[model samples]
Target: MTSHPAAEAFGATLTPGTRPTVLAVDLMRAYFDPASPLNLPDDGCLHSAARVLEAARAHDVPVVHTRVSYGPGGLDGGVFFRKVPALAQLVGDSPMGELMPEVAPRGDEVVVVKQYASAFFGTTLATTLHARGIDTVVVVGVSTSGCIRATVVDAIQHGFVPLVVEDAVGDRAPEPHWANLHDLRTKYAEVVDEPTAITYLEGTS
Candidate 1:
């Protein structure tokens, strides 16, 4: 673990466990489709996440993916869907809910669907990882200020080291995105670059 003056001051630094798993959260087509409100103009983050996933799979690392969908009329989404009408595109079998082809989950790799921001909320993510003896969660995917932040916070609370790939998560605007990343780096998780994350995954046994 490299020493950071801020981390030293805050007394918050993380040591990633030997058993690391890739948790690619919300890598959906909605963020890539031009007509979709969720579409991000610059999708470099998606490409970065794709590379991270490739490295994790090549190194035999366990992988888990997440997608958000609500029941018809978003009854399952509760207040969140009503708050963000864009969620309508992800209802049921809408093509917008499809996993992005680049980082799509393959056979046998676990995929969890949820209605909320945090992957662990009302989901079996924590239990599932604990069952497999997974101790570190390497996170990559969209909207750094939302789902990614929520997942990392919960991962730390659930006793999993959260290693967020800084280059592999994005938001509609840079302000909230960078602000949340800085906070996560200092308080919740180790926000590292994509290459750093990939190297770590490759080095893990």
Candidate 2:
């Protein structure tokens, strides 16, 4: 709702549906570990996402998580792998591809392995959500300008309402983080904080 030109021009906002699901996108070691080349700025985003996960579990909401991985030599990944050399470290048997313990998926949760930014790109995410009767997707995870943004867009395109938890999504730089959040809030999804998302998940909103 800022006075930005784009926000004023389009001003589209997606409202969350009653049957909501939690989607933790790409909360993996490579983005959380400091030693990894893909490490993000800090762990604040992870902590916020963990809180949302706790709320989701408490409410017995369908929780889905995504991790990016590739087969040996990244043959499964075409141009994407070649464009980002750092992605080579995530292929086959690499610890970097594993989801971080902070926001790990539970036994009954769905874990979608994808090579691209959108969870719905080459996966059965949309179909699975449809089968589960899920209408709203409460999203949290790393790199807001990347997978988070892509997932939000795809979620809306696939006919699911996307609600992005602002504090739970981070980026390599603050500028892109803030910028993408603004754009997402203005158009694609409903950008919210962790508390707002949890309230909605609990059906109190």
Candidate 3:
């Protein structure tokens, strides 16, 4: 991997904490179903996310899944709803809003419902993590340039080490995906592959 000069200068590779919680962000049907407007090209993210989830479960690491939802008229989504009309399909009892079965949350896991791109935005995620003594957040989900990036930025700001599993996240386009990963690696979080993240989870647990 080529190191960025800015990242090298700023010392951006922050150490991960011993305690980690897998923050699976928006791996829902909308992003997985090819027929859906928000769909990506393939189910690669589902497979990767499932592997990370399996590792987390076996290691007894905490897992939290986030789904985007809005109010009836999208009044709760605010300007964000207006900005992105496709998000309207996620509100209410829309089946597209549901999580993909492959990466479904177990009953024991916390499911965070959010309206904005950032999982921490207008949610109790920070407090929930604090209560559980989780110092590191392992983020995995769809759209690297969107929610995944937003969540990583928020996770670090809230005083937690953020590690983004590269393969476990995807975007509709490869350019934005790779670009965001590079940006996140240089700025907000550690960008690792699924195997590396699994090793970390097992070692810590």
Candidate 4:
């Protein structure tokens, strides 16, 4: 099952966590709006993500969401905001920053507001999941090479298994998207498909 020489030699890879939690990150309007520079172009990931969310809800798994927000002038955004000026769209009440209806969190789901790419950074995500005894995080959302990748790496470091759904994460370009997913599958997380994710959620509750 190994895809690389080292992996085949050592058989080192990630595994799925038995107790599942659905984590939807940055499913915001900016990524879906063609006019926005953050637009992902292929919106199919949204539909796949919505399906995974629905399955999670049906099975009664814990759910959490993360969205980026910056105060006026983005002073709180720090270097990240300076590097990506386009993130300004997420500031305040901009419609582009709102969660996409397709994957928006329902009442009672934890909504984490963060300034950086990793959901666990500057947020209560790790402690919250750890407190609940959630062993694995099923992640879905935008920007495979950025936020998704960052979150996956941290999830494992924090002891929560990270399962990144390939069909449910998007990037501006295919190269970074595929490359990150590939590296993650071998190193940090188990990069699965939408069907596998749904199956995992269905088995929960």
Candidate 5:
């Protein structure tokens, strides 16, 4: 791989794991709507995520997806609902809060409805992964500076090695996207591209 200044300076490397679970985080319509305040222009990330999903399926790796949805009247959201008042609008019934069509969750795949950034926060994600014997996580999805970053950090804290697929994650702007990837590469997770991750997963399995 060609070296990037930040990546080189950090000297981070990902140790491939034999058992990997793929986590697709918040690749929903709210992130794609042109008028939405959170929309990221470089949404090609979803395509990369879809490719990773395909590879995961081919390898029979467990797949998990997370979306932020509040209950009716925002009862399930609590303080997080108040912090981002707009979340109240994304009630369980809101179609806009659903995963985007391009990367829709499969029938047997686990869909985690979380109100916070970290997928493991107040959710069954960690327990489910543990139950399934997952030791590594291949992460893909939107808002690299937000949910993706939170997931990476929490994955490490939860004892799972995080492998962040760079091209499969996006942010509202390039600056946050690049900065967060750099930080993740240095301190939290292994920042890699889709093909590298897919090949590693295939080889390990």
Candidate 6:
């Protein structure tokens, strides 16, 4: 059998302590809003992501959710906030900024609110995962060309193996999605479909 490069690189030596955790990032209202310039309605990754979430739950893998929200008046948001001025409205109680119901935060599960593309940048996500004994991350969510890609890169940088679920992530446009996924598959993380990922997680679990 032909070995997948990423599976050869990282999947071969997974240990019992290195439990896989699922991170559903930025599947929020702002991404789906028609008025938002960053909207990616045609990217039907959310439904696939929901399926991943269900599978993760069934397999007992820890689930974490992330949303990009600025603090009051976007005080915590720096230069990046200025570039996307509209993102400032996501702070506090803005309805347009909340995580969509289908992938909403559940009781006791970790929810990370980030201000930048990398979920681990200036966030408690890394610490939380480390404390939970999570060494591998199954990353799913919106805008494959943006935050999802950034998080996958950072996850690898932090010494955690990141597995990108192919159909479980979306982007505003097709070109960037294809380009980023290509780059990720070669460099940052292993890119696999939901079924393969579920099987891998199950085997490792």
TM-score winner: 3
Better candidate by lDDT, 4 or 6: 4
TM-score of each: 0.95, 0.94, 0.95, 0.94, 0.90, 0.88
Worst window of 10 by summed lDDT in candidate 4: 7-16
| Candidate 3 structure quality by residue, lDDT tens digits, 87-181 | 98988968998998888999999999999999999999999999989999999998899999999999999999999999899999999999999
Per-residue lDDT of model 5, residues 1-205, tens digit only: 9666864666567685778999999988888887676677977999999999888888888789999888788888888778876666588767668788877888999999898989999999999998888899999997899899999999999999999999999998899999999888889899998889889777765
TM-score of 1: 0.95
The residue pairs found clashing in candidate 1 are none
Question: What is the per-residue lDDT of model 2 for residues 1-205, given as tens digits with 9 covering 90 to 100?
Answer: 6576753677666667888999999999999788888899788999999999999899888899999889999999999999999899889868998898988889999999999989999999999999999999999997899999999999999999889999999999999999999888878889888889888888823
Against the hidden true structure, what lDDT does model 3 obtain?
0.92
lDDT of 6 at 122: 96
RMSD values for the candidates in order, in angstroms, are: 3.6, 3.1, 3.2, 2.9, 4.4, 4.5
Q: How many residue pairs clash in each candidate?
A: 0, 0, 0, 0, 0, 0
Q: Which pairs of residues have clashing backbones in candidate 2? A: none
If the candidates were sorted by their TM-score against the true structure, best first, what order would they fall in?
Answer: 3, 1, 4, 2, 5, 6
Q: What is the lDDT of residue 192 in candidate 3?
A: 92
lDDT of each: 0.91, 0.90, 0.92, 0.90, 0.87, 0.83
lDDT of 4 by residue, 1-205 (tens): 7466674754265667678899999999999999999998799999999999999989989889988888898989999999998999888768988999988889989999999999999999999998888999999998899999999999989988889999999999999999998888878888889998998788776
* lDDT-superior candidate, 4 or 5: 4
Task: Give candidate 4's error at residue 190 in angstroms.
Answer: 0.3
lDDT of 2: 0.90
Q: Looking at candidate 2, what is the lDDT of residue 6?
A: 51
Model 2 misplacement above 4 A: 1-8
